[model samples]
Target chain A: MKEKPVLRVTSKLLIPPIMLFALYVQFHGDFGPGGGFQAGVIFASAFILYALIFGVDVARRIVPAWVSRAGLSIGVLLYAGTGVAALFGGGNFLDYSVLAHDALHGQHLGINVIEFGVGTTVAAAMVTIFFTFASQSPHDPEDLRDEDDDADFDDDFDDDLDDLIASRTMSQGLSQAGGAGGREAR
Target chain B: MELAVVIGMLFFMAAIALAIIWVRNLFAVTMLMGIYSLTAAALYVALDAVDVAFTEAAVGAGISTVLMLATLSLTKAEEKPFRSIQHPVSLAVVLVTGGVLIYGTLDMPAYGDPDAPIHQHVAPRYVQDSGQEVGPPNIVTSILASYRGYDTMGEVTVIFTAAAGVLMLIGRGRSGPGRRRKTWDYEDLEGDER
Candidate 1:
């Protein structure tokens, strides 16, 4: 993935806008055509693109395993905690009307808070799943022995084909299929 | 006009599906699946489900494609050749199920029918007063975050659970002595591993 000036420059130009759009979707979801789930996925996708172009290791350093894990737990807690707060606010479980002095204001606050919680968890979950998959041992040689009879030939061909397809389709970020390079880069 | 657009999009989706089925390369299949998801997202827009469209575009087209590509790296790029495509029993079962599904829809209300049973339910209240009640102009957001808050919370929890499951299965953090070495010399690591 290294030594690709075009890809690196393109990613640098595009990533900020993508992140901004994700935030727009996250916040404007209240008045428009997006919400937590969409925004979260969008947010993670920018990082995924970054990972693909640079390397998985770089992406991991930016949003480490612990950070994503914290997001996963904290998001759920924020949501559930909101409900618990409502219980203490002299309302039933999950009720939002009593959170503020007025019902409408309370609803606004509750909805925004919960939506943020949802976004956080979703984004974290996606990043975690991707990182886990990305970081796995590329192959268990024994598993390939039976299924891929021409293992040596097929492996090389698959790597080239993967690179070809990735470059052609994505138009940037080459060399994801080289697990050897990926591991060594780490 | 909207109906025509929907039908055209549906045809595109069907074509993509067929292409996916015909393609043996896993990479092409993944790409086709992304296209199919994009078409579906467009269909959602035509049907006025913008939220769903956004979700489909981001999650279905974007995330799923990337994940599938990552998985492809871990496995084979080409699908194994199948022995036979003519499975009469399976075909019969699919035809029967699809027929039943279409038959079921025949009993439902027409598109945008105002007198539908759903329109008569609590939907009226949500549609009419949700702006004032929830304070969001987008009724979908209002319902999702306020009226149906529990369901959304459950969905968030489900996502969290999925993350937890993935973490337990594979995200054990960077462990093992080999990974910990972390030298910048690619050749050294390569030689050692080989």
Candidate 2:
């Protein structure tokens, strides 16, 4: 994976355009077929591509899992909050007509706000999900553990392919495997 | 000519579906499923469901394929052969569901009929007045975000709920934190290892 120069360069070039398209899809939903859900997925995918290229550790540092968890909650709050805002403005729950001075203006403003909330939640959730799945086994040991103990652990590795008992520690194996490549110098 | 093109595309989609069913390789199936969604997106375009086409192409064809490939990397590349006897219950369930679906279609009006219940009912009003009422150039947006605001909220909630469920199931923190300390600095890690 680290050896593919063509993929690395192409993906590096594609990430920004992908993110920009996601933004366009997010804001242009009102005038086109796109909306929060599609835009959110699109946005998350750009980061997913980045993670695939640069490895999960760098991606996690950029957009931590805790932030994503917060985003998931915040997006829901924003949508529900918009409804409450409309209600407090003398309309029923989610009645955007009363959200502003004029009904049309209120509708426009409310929809935009809610869509933003939707986009935020979706992008965060998708990215978090990808992180959780991708970071499950191979990448965690490298970043989350001490390299000293990791090296000591790897030194005890049995070269016998038939010894399944020696393969108990997946983290130990992955660290040795990845570090042995030595090409992914970031 | 348009009808011929549509028919050809439909045939291609059918072939892909049959291929998906026939192929034993999970990786090939994943690729076929991507093709399946792309074709579905094309069908949406043929039907002039541009918004749906966009979603079908982006989410259905693009993101889902990547996600599936990611999932595949976590597990075996080939599906195991069936170890259990085929169940009559599954066949019964499928037949019953198909029969019910076909029955439901009996009451559906002809495709694009002007006097269809859907066209005759609230849709005409939506088409005629949505521009003035919702004040958006896109009637679809007006209907989804304003006219059907509650429904859209519910859709967003569904995504949130699904993501929440998945996070709860497979999320981080299961590996027993506090078991190890972080050693992120490269120079410090090299010193420690030495």
Candidate 3:
């Protein structure tokens, strides 16, 4: 089977401008038609399109699954950390005004930090979802083999073989069949 | 100020809306929906709500359509062939709701009225003091991040929750590796013949 091409040269060409636009939105939210959340999603979507065109394995190599999970956790932590910092500063949760001794600049700094955090988490979560789905096995081999074997076997032996294959496949297919051994392998 | 532009925009919006309702193909409907969002964003710009227009453009034209397309991939393209008779009672309910909305709009201020209640209320505070209060050049950012910061936080939490839910529902569950192993075993059987 011909594998569908995921990232075309044209798509690669398209990503730069879109990413630049996302940056424009992120930094220029003070002036223009974009903000952190929107820019983050757009940025993530560009990668997502790349993954869709390319295989998930390639995408995973670019942004690995463990890294994506860490990205998500870090993004949330960065956001909540800012909030915690404010709390330590004797302000309410996420009170930007208290972030610095100079109240005015503190709010600006706080908003920027939080938005960045939100953007990161959103992007990472999106890629993670794509990876999770892409990683799922769409076919079962044992079932196929047993079906094939049944076709070759004689009627007398066929029923016995079928029952044995069915039970074995069932036990293997269910994840909890051998608890400790399976967990260790994983 | 031109009569032609206003008429054209209205006609375009109507045409797009009609297309959305009329298209039987889900893919076509999704494309039309993107067009509808873009046009609506344009309309928001024309109405001078640049901030709202920006958001509508990004969320509606960008993210929503991507999500819709992603969802479409997991399901069949066509609607099921079953048809239900249009009930008069349901039609009446829709008409009544629309009528009420129209009736409410009739009493409201005309488009872009400076003296409107909306302009006189919390908006003026946001416009005037946002730069001074929040120290951000953009009033929309200040409002979204500071004035209504709690709501923004809530929105983020909601998205996080949704992402978690999707991850849980679809991520590497217990059976996945076993399924892969079963496939590998079958492939081994095929290889044995060679």
Candidate with maximal TM-score: 1
Local accuracy of candidate 2 as per-residue lDDT tens digits, B17-91: 999988866656877998999999998888888878888888788777767756644444456677766899998
- CA RMSD of all predictions: 4.8, 8.3, 11.2
In model 1, the clashing pairs are none
Looking at model 3, give its docking quality level.
incorrect
For candidate 1, the lDDT comes to 0.78
Residue B182 error, candidate 2, Å: 11
DockQ leader? 1
**lDDT per residue, candidate 3, A1-186, as tens digits?**
012233256567888888888788788876665677877777777776665554344555688757777777777777788888999999999888999878888997888888887777877777776555444442332433344333333233325533222222222222122232321222
Span of 10 residues, lowest total lDDT, candidate 1 chain A: A167-176
Q: For this target, which candidate reaches the highest lDDT against the unseen true structure?
A: 1
For candidate 1, give the lDDT of residue B126.
Answer: 95
Better of 1 and 2 by TM-score: 1
Candidate 1 positional error at B133, Å: 1.5
Ranking by lDDT: 1, 2, 3
CA lDDT scores, all candidates in order? 0.78, 0.72, 0.65
What shift in Å separates residue B154 of candidate 1 from its native position after superposition? 0.7
